[model samples]
Target: MFVLDANNPEALAECLKELNWLAADENIVTLTIPGAGNMNCVLRVDTGKRRFIIKQSRAYVEKYPQVAAPEERVVTEAAFYDKVREIPFLQGYMPRKIGVDVSNKLLAIEDLGPANDCTVLYNEGEQLSEETFTKLLEYLSGLHQQFMKNKVDDELENEEMRKLNHEHIFKYPFMVENGFDLDTIQEGLQSLALPFKNNSLLRQKVEVLGGLYLSKGKYLLHGDFYPGSWLQTEKGIKVIDPEFCFYGSREFDLAVFIAHLYLSGQKEDLIALVADKYEGFEQLNRSILNGFVGTEIMRRLIGLAQLPLEMNLERKKTLLDFASKLILNEKI
Candidate 1:
């Protein structure tokens, strides 16, 4: 079994040879870290001949070591790529799986060259074009529609990752006092936690949504569908990081997409347009969808997993208020 290390060129060279990614005479390879994801070690391996990405999961989060994660999540991620390969609409949008090292718990896949994550648009104060949003929504709707009522593969179910995600999205943000210091992320942010912890009605509403999130398994979902997971390239938009993929409500993915757009300061009309264009599963629950979106907005604003948004304190307060309204089943 060969283990890959981004820091050691010699080890990477040996790994390339072991994986047959390098010819015996071709030893030169370059490695670079690509993005800011917490869970896995993602490295881009460039041989003079070609380029590919090697991703491996750590037993604990790479960014926050105290938080434990399942290494088996890589197996589930590889399974997702395998499943999508067969689906006509989802074929090219995902990276092609090159190979998997189960003992090492690593996956190697095709690298979409020189693409930027959608988060860069928000971070740089660039606007998301309507065409991009339409394409994204259309892709998502097609995925949901294609897999609705279809048999979910037992290996692809990924219960462990789903439970882990549920805690982050549902339970952690509302904790009265977890060791997580929101103020460290930004001063005075801890004050926001008091209201979320003390308000029983708000807790009740969140708990209700949490229940729905746990029980509803209507369609296959790209569990973490935020801007960070979306990539823009000369070719088209490509979605990545489905370690959290699972059988869950289609509404969850839609809500997550909408919440990130709202936080990015996209126009309300544009947001409405994107929502209207998505033709999801029959009789989707608006309240539940709104509630999920509301929770995602609040969690990102004050929770442990934060986005790099360029918003002032006053604007954050306004978004918090709006999030509360959505959570309470009130129209925003």
Candidate 2:
């Protein structure tokens, strides 16, 4: 029942000491938020001698406190780190798991200092470099191919978080009255989003994809794989924050990746590169991937989880129409 508070250094130090993550005499030099995060309480802890990250998932989301979430999500993230430790390639692209306090829902990880997340891509004029994209895909491809379970069991199911995500990604965005005002995000966005929300066929197809997202599959997926989870560090494109991960379709992961490319206004060639580089891309169910991709795009625009997209209303409408086509299989 211990809560993490960056404001209270005495309490944090005591908790860290009790968990053996910090020495009795280790003084906390400073505690600062590493970057923009939505799901969990994350802070960069500097002991003057060294630095690391401490993350905890509370009963509600860190960004939207009114929204409820699984408290043990950080534990699942820790498990993901443990699961991928043997994979040398994946290890290189992610922060190392240092320790975990399951009861308190706290985790300590190696700090990739001054390394900003790729969220800047969402801003104007910023682009996702081909090199970074390739490294990210390679990490994701390896994660799906390796470290897979034969049959979907209860391990790392993370159903609570999945259900929470299911609402935002599938159900909420399309609702005519989800209490979220899209126009607040943009002047004409709500009016533009109305057509998709009211489309019967589009809603039906999106519902089918939502079921697939909930269903268990053979491959382990990094549930939230957008640019937000990627870090552009000195080493390369280091991936972080797999709290929403589960044993699900690899298509969901790849679909989210491609969706962000389109959202960020990345060129068609870079978007097309996914099919060429992803291992077994041809073998995947293209229809399913397209559905997920379309849903991701729509949800990001119309749903509660808004991105810092520097796009105009006209562009959003175009993307919304394009997303509808992907959902309905009218377009690739």
Candidate 3:
């Protein structure tokens, strides 16, 4: 149940107005719970015959004015989901977008309350059955292929994206700049100091990422892909939260997905597990896993959104150590 705040009704009302969904008979109730992100409030609206999720975007999330809602990107999201529907292999892994109120940054998505979070699938000691895993791999592989097939070669692109990926996600995270808290991570570890001390190594990784990204053939990639972004239901698995999706390497997405699996300790033979499920996967996806896996680990570690495994030092010391070792060994 979502606790009603004074502003929630107003927010919902505004969103409905923006979406042209403000019907005299429709009843909308704001949820007491907020989503994990900084910019949105989730609400469940019962239209009697059906229900929908309303995500209202916020402007001043954490007093960051520049981080306003990317209303224009909502169009991108809708187009992506529409394209997702066309792929025969990915029929089960995407949601049917109902409507979008881009001006309000409000999205009306298919009600997924009845579906179970995929994280619960792992936590319950039930590995995603081979059937589901195989389906997922095929969907991902096909999605990447379709993305490449759909890209327009002549469109002029903005450099802001590249700058964001490099500066905010990579460079700023590792540096002891005003935005980052370097001492917090460095306090207990001396061996890990080599990364911070050697600027050349950091620059090399950045250059490597740029080169890998430039070789991209895919249309767009979900920069962040983990179980949390998926929900499994009786029908099948549906992916949500494509906010971080961008034009980049297919290996980048695959690596992040694998690392998330490893971090959760869901499977021992990671490559073998994915390889078995994704038929002829090696031909399509060789061990590009080696480079980006560590890059992803470090990106999550020191970056603004560090992994939960790194912060919870007590219970997940082993996981943290593993991540640390990967960061060191891979020099990410």
Q: Under the 3 Å rule for N, CA and C atoms, how many clashes does model 3 have?
A: 4
- What total of clashing residue pairs does each candidate reach? 0, 0, 4
Higher-lDDT candidate of 2 and 3: 2
Q: What is the clash tally of candidate 2?
A: 0
Note the Cα lDDT for every prediction shown: 0.82, 0.91, 0.56
**Judged by TM-score, which candidate is best?**
2
Task: State the displacement of the C-alpha of residue 24, model 1, in Å, after optimal TM-score superposition.
Answer: 4.0
User: Over the full model, what C-alpha lDDT does candidate 3 score relative to the true structure?
Assistant: 0.56
What is the lDDT ranking, best to worst?
2, 1, 3
Q: Please write out the lDDT profile of model 1 over residues 36-55, one tens digit for every residue.
A: 76788889888778888988
Selected candidate, larger TM-score, 1 vs 2: 2
Q: Extract clashing residue pairs from model 1.
A: none
Residue pairs clashing in model 2 are none
lDDT of 3 at 116: 57
Cα lDDT tens digits, model 3, 143-227, are 6666673654522122333344555544655555434554466454323433442556654655566566545444567555777
Worst 10 residues of 1 by lDDT: 148-157
Model 3, position 61, has a per-residue lDDT of 33
